[model samples]
Target: MAQIAVFFLFLAVIQASVALKCKVCDDTDGSCSKLRDETCPAGASDREAACLIHIYKDATTKKEMTEKKCVNRFKNTGKYDCIENPNNQQIKCYTCVEDFCNEKNSATKLGLFGIVSLVLSILVSKIL
Candidate 1:
């Protein structure tokens, strides 16, 4: 029973270490709307695993552009909504830490649920 509990605990920890898959596309080429999956390098650092979506308007052309890719995030960062660039207000950016999370533009809702499920499974295994 304890071995089963240990196996469940190992799986939960392993889940946290996997790299996230972020959408990688550009509106300039119209690939942003495609279904192909682009992923960051496996086992990348936390800073390099987040998804980034950058959208902005062109200054001279007055056109809007969009880009999506996995990008390294600033250290010690928290979640943020799409925000205007400080240097160029026309550029808006959003970053998140789950697979294709940039498109969703929100925190991954699975973390808490996964933790709860892991705990419950461990308890059930011990009881058995």
Candidate 2:
């Protein structure tokens, strides 16, 4: 029936929108800096659509810290609240939609990939 077709189409569109994925990782050494392919968890809400990366320094030790997670902007308006002293302790928050957009070193990876591709292309050309 026409109604059934329309309903199915609507459902498909909703599914696609809700199924949006984002890279997720929490690491101190930055090993998990790479973006993941599939990011949606079971029964995730709309707020989890955004990727959040929060970088700050330890108050006592002054060690660089990083927190990467999925956030719902509707609930969390501010990214950092522990900044009691701006000069001593400062926090930076980054929000993005694309996968691995939160990775601070993403550009480095892309540059390395480009270099490798160029080398391979040159080798192929020489061989031919």
Candidate 3:
């Protein structure tokens, strides 16, 4: 029983460590509806990868450019944030995890649910 639990934990770790899939696009306008999905590659110093939604607006013309791509994980936390650039002009970056998680109605629900579901199933099997 202990070994089974350990095996499940190991599998969960492996699943979490897999490459992240992000929506990739660079649009002149504000449309990002039809974009490509790409799996993030390994980063320098073995850092984790994440989905990046970078938006830059021209202060003078007010022209906006939206770019979605996979980037080397900026922070260790998997939470999404839309932070403004201090030095740049009207540039914001939103980062997230999970496949195609750069959309507007995206959720950070990743492999945690699967890991919990599998562990619960294992517990039920042992009980029965």
Candidate 4:
């Protein structure tokens, strides 16, 4: 029972290391409209709509990249209308800024190392 509890606790701690947020698009002045017509014109079907994007950092190096829905968002143009497209009116894979993982913060690093040491000590004890 204690081992199971410790394993779950470790998982929870690791899960807390992950963070997410909308990476501000560099093109179109952070506007979905301009991005639709400029940066990724080919990918943009409608000139208006909230373009949702999924982003994350590389597991090994913590580099930011678009994993899915890499669409662009228009500026604060207040134009929330949908344009026409041959296939569908959904916007995906637009322009976006790179998102970086902040897990390397001093506090986070300390906590991570502490947890790792604790786990290692527990394993060593069990082995001995």
The most accurate candidate by lDDT is: 3
Worst 10 residues of 4 by lDDT: 100-109
> lDDT per model, in order?
0.64, 0.51, 0.67, 0.36
lDDT measured at residue 40 in model 4 versus the true structure, 0 to 100: 22
Clashing pairs for model 1 are none
Please, what are the lDDT tens digits per residue for candidate 1 over residues 6-124? Answer: 77777777766677777777445523575346777643244456777777775555566676777666446744355554444455577776666666435454555448659966796
Cα error of candidate 4 at position 97, Å: 17
Who is ahead in TM-score, 3 or 4? 3
Better of 1 and 4 by lDDT: 1
Give the per-residue lDDT digits (tens) of candidate 4, residues 15-124. Answer: 43332222224443223222221122222444322223433443444444432222334445424233333443233333332222111111112234445656765765
Off by over 4 Å in 4: 18-22, 32-128
lDDT of candidate 3 over 1-128, digit per residue (tens) = 66666666666666676778877874545656568768888776645677887777755566675778787764556544555545436566767777667755344646564568568657855865
Deviating ranges (above 4 Å) for candidate 3:
1-3, 26-30, 60-64, 74-91, 105-107, 112-128
Our model 3 lands, by Cα RMSD against the true structure, at: 4.3
Q: For candidate 2, give the lDDT.
A: 0.51
Q: What TM-score quantifies how close candidate 1 is to the native fold?
A: 0.62
How far does residue 8 in candidate 3 sit from its true spot (Å)? 2.6
Ranking by lDDT: 3, 1, 2, 4
| TM-score of candidate 4 on Cα atoms, chains taken together | 0.21
Write candidate 2's Cα lDDT for 30-122 as tens digits.
Answer: 445544545644332424455566667766677766666665543244332322355445566666544445656231222233344455555
